[model samples]
Target chain A: MKNMYEILINALQADELIAQVTILNGSNVGEKLLLWPDGRKYGGLGSEKLEKQIIEKAKELFQRQETRKLEFELDEGRISIFIQVYPPSPRMIVVGAVHIAVPLTELGKTMGFRTIVVDARSAFATRERFPHVDEIIVKWPSEALEALHPDEGTYVAILSHDAKFDIPALQVPVQSKAKYVGVLASKHTYSILHEALRENGVSEALLGKVHTPIGIKKLGSRGPEGIAFSVMAEMIAEMRGVEIT
Target chain B: MRDVMENISNWREEGKQIVLATVVKAYGSALRPIGSKMAISSAGDISGSVSGGCVESAVYEEAQSVLANSEPRLVEYGIADETAWSVGLTCGGTIEVFLELLD
Candidate 1:
């Protein structure tokens, strides 16, 4: 018999969507069925009918990317199973090596995100500055974003606070599947950038997706570290589906 | 779970019998969410935790029985549970844990 633990570790290491179904009730309590996205099965949940039903449910939960415990009324009895879905960790694309970006990248890693720091200046985006960042890209905003390819699990932060860099950086992420696209700027700067982006052919709906004056509201972060912390707090709230004031 | 696997592997190399416990479900504000796991060696060595600090001793006792019978079982704990006075969790939430022999 194949070890379920080995299969679990392998799926996790490969960043695959692996669903673990544990029967909590019925005659087969504690039986497990590990399902991979490719339809590979590691173990059985006792009966073929039950396994098929549970696999269909698992696929639905995987789409939502959530872990849930559910109860079903079968002829045998009421059966409960915990469907735990493990997806790849989210990615944080920090589009500046500024003071705020330094702490933001650190907070990203601490919060279990794969952090990447991108800057056009090689001097700023050096290994010494961000020792813990997963990847450091010494390229401009357009080129960096083109290579990074923001997806549903990606969070993009434009921390340069300069229109020259921030404008170009904001264009792609606003339309990408990134869950969050935030730009650090003041009220006046934000207004100007929004107008510029609108004139540059970005739709209002797309610009609406951008989070300006980034971070949780009323956080009152005075220092760069405090701002970074607030940003991470906002990211966490967004990820957990919690609304922030 | 990584911690449990690492220690379970080491215990297996030493020829020590072991049992595994996993938090299958957590309801109403549990500290550790579902899918948390722990391993118990026959020698009483423990790795990982399903609950932060509550109900571990109870799970440890259950592990002993599971290792003996080689049968998996489900155990639940909560603040106002039937075993409230004996091994109740003060976490104010319910957690269902499944125990199985891993040896």
Candidate 2:
């Protein structure tokens, strides 16, 4: 049996999603309840009813992915509990060793994402090219993504504009649970790739989720860094759930 | 809080008395979001930040008081026109910080 602080530090070090509920008011001030999304719990805030209510509120905050303070009126008095969620660090998976991948990886790293680069070309995916990236998988995008298990916290960028690579790269993330899947392509190239994917039996709904001609609109810039900037901007907007007109 | 966890652990291992301050609530354009934390040791060392160089000194003082008394406190800071030179956020935001001694 571990103390609440030890349990919290362990969960954080393991990159597990956990929530901390702390009573801010009432007699239970400074009381804490640590909760996991799977219903695992540690510590308590005294009352069973209060704990149940805090668990329910923690679930809602987990869905919202935010820290919030809620006021609850109990039979004894009004209690305010602050629910703070600790989610795993987000990841950025780039499926290319192209020039944009360099700055894109750098930007992702700077933005606090665990950046991984995937490419079949051993020479291009060398550590020399991506010194700061968390991982460089010298394998095909499909295989790398399959092993990586991109989840809701993952953002995938298919920067290999070549059809042979881009098509295979797009196949995994577009259909996976990745939060954002974007592809770098010209309008002409995207149409061709779109048709090719559709021909390969990809559904319209899934294909519709893919961000082709990737990056924010009206970027009005050219070159690798500019494109990376736009792509990161788009990814940030998607991560923040902001609608970009 | 994540950013300062390692430091907090190190301080705890060294048998240092530590106070943890967390931003429990924010209003308006708060520079730091809710759940941001700052850790202060009895030796006056600090880790992480609760605001963009605003209200931290005040929070530090409050942390010292909490360390001395072993009592938790929730303090609110907001910009006041009358007390223009006081400790408050220049970003025109209000933030409530909870300070507690970390055992």
Candidate 3:
């Protein structure tokens, strides 16, 4: 039991996704089963057959990153197990440290996201500008993203508004497995970017992934702060697999 | 669950028996989502919250019994009936919490 305690602490502190399964209702109530992200199993729920079923179920819920009480009918009887999943904070990569990125990163941190801001201009991407951001890279989007390696948990927002930065920033996430990639631009700017991306060999299918005019439509031209709010909200909706117009 | 790590560790090192109560399932709208946890020490020290203060008192009573007997229990609170008004969730949600002894 103490070993289980140690493992849970270490895994959470290290930001590893793991699940702790506790028998919520059964003769073996309070018995636990722990599962690692790599399919490794530790501890047990006291029955080999029951544990096998839970291992399979854990993987399913683990992917969705949800926690719930699951009831299963085993050879012994009906048992309810509480599956507690702990996933690391999702990564939010802001591709420009502009005025919007300031509030965007602040809101991102408040919402429990690991935020990074990348901009080639050191004057803009300074510690004083983004005090709460986890990382600030003063490299061009092309160079920064190459080392950043955006993955499925990453959410990238291109706010540079310049073709030099926006074009390559948009291109990088489209080629990666990032869940959400948004570009801040007006209709005229979006049209220009669309043509440039097409000329740069970004396929129509990949270009479709970019959310142009990035903030939620209901925001209605409020300014940088409100736009930042809308953009972060849209990013969250995308991360949760929600559909938005 | 992660925020109260230091408190949980200190409680265990002090040889205090502890009970962990976790929100396993929530129906309708809930303030806290499933997997929210609260740890109660034998001396009645609480480090976290399972609810947003709607039912911690009831859970604390339950934790005392769990620590005394080393037994685990699944408890449910909701506004299903007029008598349930004492512990009713104003948000009209039913939260099922699983309580267990943590040695």
Name model 1 segments beyond 4 Å from true. A24-30, A70-80, A126-128, B1-20, B38-49, B60-71, B82-88, B101-103
**Each candidate's fnat, in order?**
0.55, 0.59, 0.86
**Clash pairs detected, candidate 3:** none
TM-score of each prediction: 0.80, 0.85, 0.82
Model 1, A144-215: lDDT tens per residue? 997788998999999988898988889888878888999999999999989989999999999987877899
The TM-score measured for candidate 2 stands at 0.85
Model 2 superposed RMSD (Cα) = 3.0
DockQ leader = 3
lDDT of 2 by residue, A71-162 (tens): 99999888778899988879999998999999999999878788999999998999999999989999988889989988999999999889
Q: Best to worst by lDDT, what's the order?
A: 2, 3, 1
Residues B3-102 of candidate 1 have per-residue lDDT tens digits of: 4666887888899988888888888878887878889998889998988687888999899998889888888888777663377577788888888876
lDDT leader: 2
Query: What are the runs in model 2 whose C-alpha is more than 4 Å off?
Result: A1-3, A74-76, A122-134, A220-223, B9-16, B80-85
DockQ of 3: 0.75
Which candidate do you rate higher for DockQ, 2 or 3? 3
State model 3's lDDT: 0.86
lDDT per model vs. reference: 0.85, 0.88, 0.86
DockQ, all candidates in order: 0.51, 0.70, 0.75
Better of 1 and 2 by TM-score: 2
